[model samples]
Target chain A: MLDYPALAALAEIIRRGSFEAAAAALNVTPSAVSQRIKGLEERMGQVLIHRGPPARGTATGLRLMQHLDQVRLLEDTLDAALRPASGPATLRLAVNADSLATWFPPAMAALPVLYDLVLDDQDHARDGLRQGQVSAAISSDPEPVPGCDVLPLGAMRYLALATPDFLARHFPGGVTEPALRAAPAVIFNHKDGLQSRWVQKATGKRLHLPGHLIPASEPFARAVELGLGWGMIPEAMAAPRLRPLLPDLPLDVPLYWHVQRAMVPALTPLTAAIRKRAAADLRP
Target chain B: MLDYPALAALAEIIRRGSFEAAAAALNVTPSAVSQRIKGLEERMGQVLIHRGPPARGTATGLRLMQHLDQVRLLEDTLDAALRPASGPATLRLAVNADSLATWFPPAMAALPVLYDLVLDDQDHARDGLRQGQVSAAISSDPEPVPGCDVLPLGAMRYLALATPDFLARHFPGGVTEPALRAAPAVIFNHKDGLQSRWVQKATGKRLHLPGHLIPASEPFARAVELGLGWGMIPEAMAAPRLRPLLPDLPLDVPLYWHVQRAMVPALTPLTAAIRKRAAADLRP
Candidate 1:
């Protein structure tokens, strides 16, 4: 029996970072925001916010935020059921920058709703799904979350690429183990093994090479284009300026879409749209 | 006692995302990687990796990754002590996008090291430091972590701004709660409450407004520059194209640098450089 108004206030405070900001967003006085939170705390007998210049959620506050998210979803579902005129619902999703930058937006565009997108690596996105921070996720993980439905969305093809000048200077002998061993490579981050996998497959031997890592997707492609080092790029993201070194060396990374097992009817259209878009866009 | 080589192999596997890729990165065969991880697991008597199409670290493997980071730091310290000519050590840090886009890189440029940078929201950056996923973090947290020393880095001043056209169209009657409630605003993300804070300070009222959310820092600024909606922009990032709506309504967000209390001497220069640069660049 939590107070819905107070719970909304709690979520607003955590999201906006202060009672004052939450007050503004909710069209109430700062004192009102503080009072609601205090009332909620008194009822629960637990402190929800850690008082600071920019306030932070206590562990209890985090649990409350999650509850708010759940309540919002259920309320939206009920509203849709009661009125056909109810406007589109919001979807909070976890995605990667590369997907957001490339193919995912068009899929989402078909859905008529506000989107709260959290961008992170695919593995991290899966973690968010498991944590209930998001109702859905686009991830590299094929395994479904405990109460989620998983759909394979095909693969993003990455080609081993380098600028023309880099190829001429470093691999004049063509793609070989010795030459690759001596050349530097670009990576999304230390956790990226696409380049290493490509190198092993290309050279038929394991060889450690100096790595120049740039953590962002666009910068990584640009780093390769600028001749910082040879690396892999999604076929769709490969700048026109980049030329493939081993043109036939393509790595297909399979991606999956995971949706909550008990999804609301409002989201079915979105899932269909995503499935159709992914089928048309991703490499087989 | 753990085998250092096996531990290194385990870290590489987690970072690279696959045994084959780790093998290539370390100049060893896939069989060698498997053997090293197997031997390490047998000694520890716990599961390290969860096998799938791609492998992921079990919680134990994640702990091993943190241990790897610590061991690497200690080894670099020893190397520096034994030889003055040691190469620049790698420093893994989590930072806010605003700082990364502006003052922070120049601070790093003054240091002699390879960098592994993880960009996330400022509060989330602090969490990464707590999880031991990073060596240092630039955070909004004023208090230090249990074993960290905190330093004030002054404030990042942000101005609430809109294109002249947007201001004219949305607030022709001048800035007020009614107009604000009706007009759309841009936000870095749902979690970004900077705009809410500024609006309240400027309007002297609390009001919920429709929002246009873009998660990336550069894109969020660009959205403001493009007149998508009014939003707060860091003073340094405000392209000349953006004009301030309420010139006096500037928000000063105080920032802090949290460093491990037992920071090695090898990182002292970087810490000093960061402090000096922050002082020179940030508004006091």
Candidate 2:
């Protein structure tokens, strides 16, 4: 059996980013925190943490932290009352930027636990689950990671949008391939393919256009509204400030909720809330 | 001399992320694009592009691309005519999220070149310029990177804020150390030290509080507004919906614009606009 106190020290060091901070939180001395980590490392025969001003967990340390969380969650399930000693449980989840900006807060509000959110492109969020960095992820890929459940949440519709002035300046000849080639685009990131996919759907060709790479969802929409470039904006997030370039060709990216089979019980409330929100906010 | 056409092919392939996409952009056949890259790789005696479905440039490849950009920008400076063949020059920069969501758009509008922005914590954005991935960066660090010019851009005032209901629920006894320990925080990310710094300033203690990690600027502010947790919000972004937890103990983080000394002429318009915007938006 592992030392629960020592494990708690290790988890706190990783979470708070220093032995001193963890010691403060645990109401112990920094030397005691160091000694606990030293003993734990000796027993494990592996260097678990990288000692930085802001400390970080090694792969082994992170796995151990995850184990500690699982044990605490299981214990909490057995107990009827909240444990003030442990404080609130921290649940790490990977979610897309658009979801966090739009319909996701209700789901986050529904949960009692503290959250460690990893924001990534919707298509790439599954990597967080696959790599064991997160217990659950909101992904566009319908496929489930091993020992995980895939719940098909409806699709997020994205429209090719830009300011009316941008359209008038760049597409005076109409939205042709040549006009698109000349116009700048506002891309989310290298991982995001929504704009390119929408273009392929609209023009039946893959054309590379020079543009701005604005990774944040709100700023990306604002970039288009400010007439910097045309971009793909989520239907739920598309405001009146931007006009659609191709109203007829909307891209519906189907999303899924991927949760570890073991964590589903602990995450039931959040899952239920996500389902409720998605139903209202997404296209069926 | 290096083959400029082959170099253009390399830049296009890296920018577009595939040989076929590069071909589409350059108005050439995919095989011709492939041949050009093959010849360039042979001449350099190193692997340049990692051939994924979405291609990526190796470090040496990226350096060569940067050289190409510098040459083009220099030529554009000399000629004073926009070159339709090369398209608008793409300038890669690193910016803090808060600035991007608030005052940075006006500066972006003043420039004619396309932007590729890497959003990072203000404290860490300088790493992008140091690593040669970006020509310029907006950072809180006053120290300039080697061969870079640092322009002091004033400070962003941050207030410790939460919704009124959150303060009532968590701090019923008042904002004591114990109350702070019990109340949840809304942290921007693990790298963000504003909350910890503010706590130290207000209470003369570093309290490790459980919280939500919302990385995006707008969503992070929204999280506090939604009563998920309290966070250090930018003065420019603090909405009327959220109340200040400590109105007197505001944290002012000084920001600087770091640009490559060699690229100052190319970036003058952007620098002037950034200075003007910062003068209006940031605290003196």
Candidate 3:
């Protein structure tokens, strides 16, 4: 209904990183790309692009982009209904790398959609959805976006464990703040705080050991198993391997699912499937 | 010079996945996107795209994309030389996720370049370099790309370890193929063959355990330490944590660095920095 053409042109400029690159992708001259964005800005009564060498979308532009993404989703749904056999629906969802590596795929496999998966840290999962990069997302955020739906998906439990040799070598006496400080450990990424949070709770110390960081979930677990250092891990995963560094630590992480409020009937089935699957696999 | 615009258009189509998305990203009409590809194919006398709901680049297309990428890098170099006062060069490099979290950042920090890091499995790091997605790459491949120079960065050793409790519980008798199959192991991803390779060589058998996948290196180590299952880990990381499953099996993985042949004056300092740093950090 709105000027979708102009709106798309603005979004493209930001997505492509520069006007020149955007023009090349658009099959248009740089001037054309600029003109389209300018016209849209004039109409909206707000500046859209930052116009830097590496261009960025202004706050208003980002909001517009989010609106455009939502519109596209709704349009896709409408098109599917109008023409059932047009093509399979393409579903874009943002999720954590750990979930992607482990329990997430089965949940997705249960759905019949052309999935475009965007993997990120759990903390940033909702960001893609907010930024119009994904239609649905799973996050630790129980708070729903104003017009989005949210569902509780239970907790993912992590236990602190270490190899006998590692514990003996690193913490000969006991798990002390000094041992925690001195010992080389493994961290998922700069963003991951499960280990840090646990350390603070147990030892009342903020720990930042010279640790090996592996961003993906599977490798992080593998690194721990190879006795890199003591770290918090999912209880289910650590079941066979559990040599607890602490007396008790099932660092329970609560997870939640967030989806667009207005979606196709297809999304209903997807939401149901995910709820069922998460409830089954995750610690409720 | 060699229809760089058209070549970019073709690559954008494949990268963005759909003609509509490509058009939006490019700020061009869908018709223009098609025309650009069509014109490119006619000029080159080759089919560059495999037209589908989700489009993919053909061998020729992928090759052209790589070529275009190289040209852009060269142009960036030229620009930097012409304007030394310009901001730091944005150097895009592909590396193993483990290195990204470990030794790689320090290596980058030593340089003046603004790094755009691409993290992948160690084995797949070279693909991005070959595809021209990255200016340089660190890989396990000692073989140089046709025009790229290869530098040996030495080997990374991974020790197989598990918690004392885990080893005692799972392998009460002794560690063997059957016990391994039953024990919960941690792995990075399906692409990661480190665990599988070690298992095969050790037991002369294939394994597909009820393993937990923690894709990130740090988390994989953490998972392992939590007694999720045994895994291969960096020797440096595992030194304090070492409860070796196989006393003699330290999975020694050789590493290499590959850089574009054309880059020298700019790359010399980077190469020196990486060499000095890697030599200092890596296991011989």
Report lDDT (CA) for all predictions. Answer: 0.73, 0.84, 0.68
How do the residues B77-194 of candidate 2 rate in per-residue lDDT, one tens digit apiece?
Answer: 7654554456778787888888888888878987788888878865456656665667889988888898889999999999999999999999888788888887889988777789
Give residue A48's error in model 1 in angstroms. 8.2
Give a tens-digit lDDT track for model 1, residues A1-284: 77978987887787666798788767789999999999999988989998775787786786677666655555665644574442233466777666765677656645545456667776767766776667788877788888788989889888999888999998999988778876778777756768878877887765666665567666566667767678888888888877887867798889888886755354677778878878887976
Q: In model 2, how large is the Cα lDDT of residue A189?
A: 74
True-structure RMSD, every candidate: 7.0, 2.7, 18.8
lDDT of 3 by residue, B101-219 (tens): 55655555354443445577654566666665566888777878766788898888788789898899989888887788667666665456687778877888755443554556665
Off by over 4 Å in 3: A8-35, A45-59, A79-92, A109-118, A121-134, A200-210, A236-242, A263-266, B1-284
The per-model DockQ list reads 0.19, 0.61, 0.03
Summed backbone clashes in each candidate are 1, 0, 41
In order of lDDT, best first, we have 2, 1, 3
lDDT of 1 by residue, B112-160 (tens): 4445666777666666667666677887678778767788998988998
Give the TM-score of chain B in candidate 3.
0.73
lDDT of 3 by residue, A1-284 (tens): 66876776675565545787567545688898888888888988989889875588886786676566556545565644574332233455667665655555656535434344556765455666565556678777777765567889888778888778788888898988778866756666545677878887887765544445455565456556766556777776674654888876668888878886765344777778778878887889
Better candidate by DockQ, 2 or 3 = 2
Error of 1 at B62 (Å): 13
Per-residue error for A226 in candidate 2, Å, reads 0.9
Per lDDT, the best of the predicted structures is: 2
Stretches > 4 Å off in candidate 2: A17-24, A27-47, A50-55, A80-84, A122-124, B1-58, B80-84, B122-124
